[model samples]
Target: MTKNIKANGLNHLAISTNNMKEQIEFYTDVLGFRLVALYWMHGVEGCWHGFLEMNDSSQVAFVFNPANKDAKVEYGVTNPGHTGGPSAPGTMQHLAFNVDTLDDLLNMRDRIRSRGYNVMGPMDHGMCHSIYFQGPEDTCLEVATFGNADYPIGPKDWIDPEVQELAGISDEELAKFTNPIEFEGQGGTIPNPGYNPDSYNPDRPVQLLQGMFAMPDEQFAMIPMEKRPPSMMSDEDRAAKHAN
Candidate 1:
């Protein structure tokens, strides 16, 4: 049996940026994060650090090292231990936060744009609406809000302009709907713009054993057998099948 553990919440995430002052300004002035602490060490040589707080009390830290010399050094690089380099893809390129409403998200986008940074979207992602932009340190950042249904129920192949408009739908109206379909990929190929099935997999196998433990037997039985892999079956059946 796997032990159940609970995490209190995220404390903070630290990343290295080229320009500390501009990054701090972007996060505080544009994104609305509050600066909790700032540090500069004397003998540490070109090191500066700042901590920013989210509304939820979670924190993120930024570190600037001016004398590190390597231009390519950045957070999430293949050799992260190295002093300086560009961050590799699949690494931490950005951080995201959840917003309460689409209006709040758009307001943030406008604020960021007013600061002379290019802003993108209010894009629809089935379960959520999001806006993206680059921060002062060239770090990608996103602010999102739950808009449509709670989850993607089918292929994301029918994102219309109307859907984008619907993202700003009121909470009461959004509650009237159920099981929204999400567009796959990073908003799909052009012409269609936001339709990509490859972005989500609807057929991922279910773990029957874990389900049985987590839910009532009746609920487990109600799950489709085809969605359950053989390994999810009872130990008796697994042993019999393996013996054969």
Candidate 2:
């Protein structure tokens, strides 16, 4: 009998960087991730590793190879003789994250700015507003907030055309439009494109944890539970636990 199979979600994403210290600073100080672990690997000369955890305990690892002494190497540069070598816009373009509120998104933008990094505005997407910044590793990152979850903004399709004409559509305005195809029953007069009326439901919360490295499933299975650190808990809960 197949044992009751419960699939666990993503544990973390790993990325190799030339400057580990900068990367750690960017993720921890600028992005608010907590540095959970750090260590050096044996038999791997000049290599170090660090792990960071988000508020939800989602983990990201950064591996540093100091032996690779090329400081000026940009992301797109590749070894000439190798075929299909590394490229800047390789398979992944960027990573996107969701925030709980518009204020949260703005606060993040401010935090990123405080680090002296240039960040793109809280641009409005059809269903969300986002801000973009480059991590210390030069990886493009985005933080977005679903318009429906915060603020008095209504769905995009529900907004009257006349109102749009009068107000002048901005990124903020566009981000307010929820996919009418997704959320249909909120009672605003948006035209439904034959979406399953009975099956229509509000969007559920989702967290996306993405990374550059892929580990073998067997290796993951071999990891002991005790070795895996507990996830990040809320400040109040953590204080209570410490008091106990």
Error of 2 at 34 (Å): 0.8
lDDT of each: 0.64, 0.63
Per-residue lDDT of 125-235 in model 1, one digit per residue for the tens? 777887876655456677788745356433354444477467875545544443444434433223322323455433434464333345654664585333334346687
Clashes of each: 5, 1
| Error in Å for residue 19 of model 2 | 1.7
TM-score of 1: 0.50
- Model 2 lDDT tens row, 1-244: 3333333554777777787778888788888889987765333555667888875657888878875566554555522111223554433356666678789999888988988988887876656788876665456678888854434455544577677778888655566544222332434334334323256334432221111013344554575332333364466754654454
In model 2, how large is the Cα lDDT of residue 12? Answer: 74
Error of 2 at 176 (Å): 30
Task: Give the TM-score (vs. native) of candidate 2.
Answer: 0.50
Question: Which sections of candidate 2 miss by over 4 Å?
Answer: 1-9, 41-46, 70-92, 147-244
